[model samples]
Target chain A: MSDIQTDLQAPLQTPAQPSEDSGLILPRRSFLRGAGTLTLSAAAVAMLAGCESAAAGTSASAADISILNTALGAELEAIAAYQVGAESGLLQKPVLDLAVQFQGHHKEHADVLAKTVRSLGGKPVDAKKAYDFPVDKLKSQNDVLGFAAGLEKGAVSAYLGAVPLFKNRDLAKAAASILGDEAMHWAVLRNALGQNPVPVAFVS
Target chain B: MSMRPIAADAIGGGPRKGAVHRAGAALRRLYALPLAAAVMVLVIPAEAAAAPDPARGQQIYDRCLACHAVENNRVGPRHCGLAGRQAGGLPGFDYSDAMRAAGFTWNRQTLDRFLADPLGVVPGTTMTYDGIKDDQERRDLVAYLLSLKPCAPR
Candidate 1:
């Protein structure tokens, strides 16, 4: 059977009997569970084509997985950071829209990274339910923008440090691509804060 | 028919100095072509060897966009004025001591060498980039950087 079929079979138990109450003869619980599994598989496949199943032996180096997970973690944090900024009520009009857009980018980065981790036969790290962002400090619009700018700057540095460390050149390229976006977000956020968008020549 | 004497000399050890001399001359003629080709290759101008493709360089510059910008400083310094600028010439951006002490101008040759190996050229430079390795890619990136108009001072 195909790998997707195998993945489906493992999660599926003995077929559930049809439910009598809801009129339809379908095995509702089992069908919904199976659909969820299929949806996840489809999402992973769509995110990265030609990914070997996680059950398969690791094709990527352990180092590559570690680097990817580190980047994924950063993306997750950025997503959370943006979400906080979005909900803070401090961002007005276009600034709020910009935060949501940047957040969406981080989500894309996270999805690709998580799928890449799975494709490499490694477990993708899960994001923590709660992040320790200094929400108490974010009282004003400038405070929120500064906080987000700091996170984007940190993400830029994280990706910069990661790009060269990957054993896989493709991974390095992916990291670099993400780095560019993070830099752009940082510049834009700084600009919104009435600060210099491009403040330095080099980032550490 | 002409080569038979040299072939015979390989098996028949009797000293035939004339045959040996003829064989040596033939070998010299065989080596001369490649030697001349090598010289021609060495002397080819950098531009003729590989014309810089600014377009391709722009694509490759995506990797650098994380920290650098053509018009304004991002994480890194702007590329405006990069062509003739000193390594650490930007006034406000903090440069690593190694970069400050690099004591080199940003010309094509210097940029090519530095892009190929940043840490090697400027050790302890704050830029974390590992450096572009492909010869053509590096050349293209340098071309793109050079193509940018120097940014007007703010």
Candidate 2:
């Protein structure tokens, strides 16, 4: 598994800026191997592959499953958040329509995540019936929209955290796509609430 | 010529010769095998290494303009002084709780991983798009992102 730092409470520190001359240097150049070396390389690669599966296979999958569940939990939370907001009778038709559509997206995410976990031979976690959102805090349409935006933002972060951990490239991309939709939803809702739609440059 | 008896050491530590030794040599070629893989199982593919192509990164960065910007606020936060910027530290942008919670500093390694698969690395971030899968493209893209003005020192 890739060495990753995903702790949510780690103190924010100033990191070095990106540059070819400085910061993290990613090794992307392919090795120039001789054609005669093919057989030898293949043998080494094969042995290494076998050993990898035998050793870290179990722990790697467990980590992947755990991250997926975290994402899945976020999706369920978003769904619940929307459900409560939609039923609050506070949003006008336009906003309510948006909320329903956003809820649908979360549902799609939840199903996909559940399926992914099951595909990995892990049991999918069930969603909670009710989330502990601050219902009493919602006093106006702006508050409701702000709350919804917050939820979408949280979902975005959850998906982002999980994106790098997925062993499958396609699954990583899928998570990215979902993140985009959630960001879009958050921006639109923020606009509705008169908050700055775009908040930062590179999302954490 | 008389055939020599096969030796037990011939399978591995012995000199490289004979058809059987040749087969073992394939797996034993220390030069071909990655040193790290020997210790750990599968090689993580190449995690991160590349030269920056800001021009290419610039081209690809167009995809991010919908939400992100170089210095000004758009649908997302400004990219000015992004280098060395703390995760979720932008002043005015209302970052996702997940981003705000992630305590990290942007570097080639973290950025590359995230660019390869945004969600795989960060999980709850709102930035969308399938990650740049190609190693060159990813490095270039991040190099370009790195070129953006970094935040001012406090």
Candidate 3:
């Protein structure tokens, strides 16, 4: 959860200007910095029920809810990142269109996360009045794409961490399904930035 | 009032029916993966082997080292048992829907095509590695990966 704590403390890093030769993107280090971020869904509800059934008032169930709430917070933050990019007024045409589409996906992610949290007896975290996004760096379309791509990659990693955490194999599969969509979003955004869409044999 | 996932596993008969979600199982499995470092060492050797420049393959595998492991899940599933395994066949590994239904074996030819263009081969795969362009590098990397064992995670 330190990753969430870190997200609250500061905005994403400003990647350097593109290299002339390889054109690599020095992605905002903090955005997808850690590969261990969590992303659970209904484990909150189902696990809580299982724990409650097994033990009346154990802190173990609370811990499960806490993980789910944190995952929900990650989704809220992701949706906000998309909103900030979409409303920045710097995007136009295809970029604008793509932003809306990606935002829609985040909304889907948010909807599922929220519903799971609510059903599990935990309150979903609300988006802050304003997030600590790298808003100042939204100077150009490429910057916007870079920022968006960075968060998409972050979500991908977050789900990667979260998927295996699920106690329900179905929920685990669900998280992996979302991870794939997030990866798809990452690939398209990178492609638009003239970055290599598939940069490795495995995507981290 | 039960809510189900919108993205159903049409081919796999729906989200691995009765799959258990043990808490901390992944963490426990990871404890046995100290050999992951060995995979890195085993993965990339420029000329450590007088063997068939498959030694060159390990160097090319550097790009893959980010998301894959010889053991368990990272941003991608572990590559420990990749050779001859059915696509998306690893139990407990969360594979993309596209990958789960890919219905192909991970032999030399299929892996080569997927390595060349992951999106082309598995239309909706989430693998972010842009395909390896060089034919030789792809071949070599696959060879090295094939030589590896799954090293069961706990």
DockQ of each: 0.02, 0.02, 0.02
The C-alpha lDDT values of all candidates are 0.58, 0.52, 0.53
Error of 2 at A26 (Å): 40
1 versus 2: better TM-score goes to: 1
lDDT per residue for candidate 2 within B98-136, as digits (tens), equals: 455445556565566656655444444444334566778
Against the true structure, what is model 3's DockQ?
0.02
Give the runs in model 3 whose Cα sits over 4 Å from its true position.
A1-64, B1-154
For candidate 1, write residues A83-117 as lDDT tens digits: 87787666665667777877877787788778788
Model 3, span A96-200: residue lDDT tens: 767776776666666765666565566765655554454654666677787677656656655654454444454456556667777777767776675666677
Decreasing DockQ order of the candidates? 1, 3, 2
Candidate 3 docking classification? incorrect
10 residues in a row with least lDDT, candidate 1 chain A: A32-41
lDDT of 3 at A167: 48
How high is the DockQ of candidate 2? 0.02
TM-score of each: 0.44, 0.42, 0.43
- Name the better of 2 and 3 by TM-score: 3
Please tell me which model should have the higher DockQ, number 2 or number 3: 3
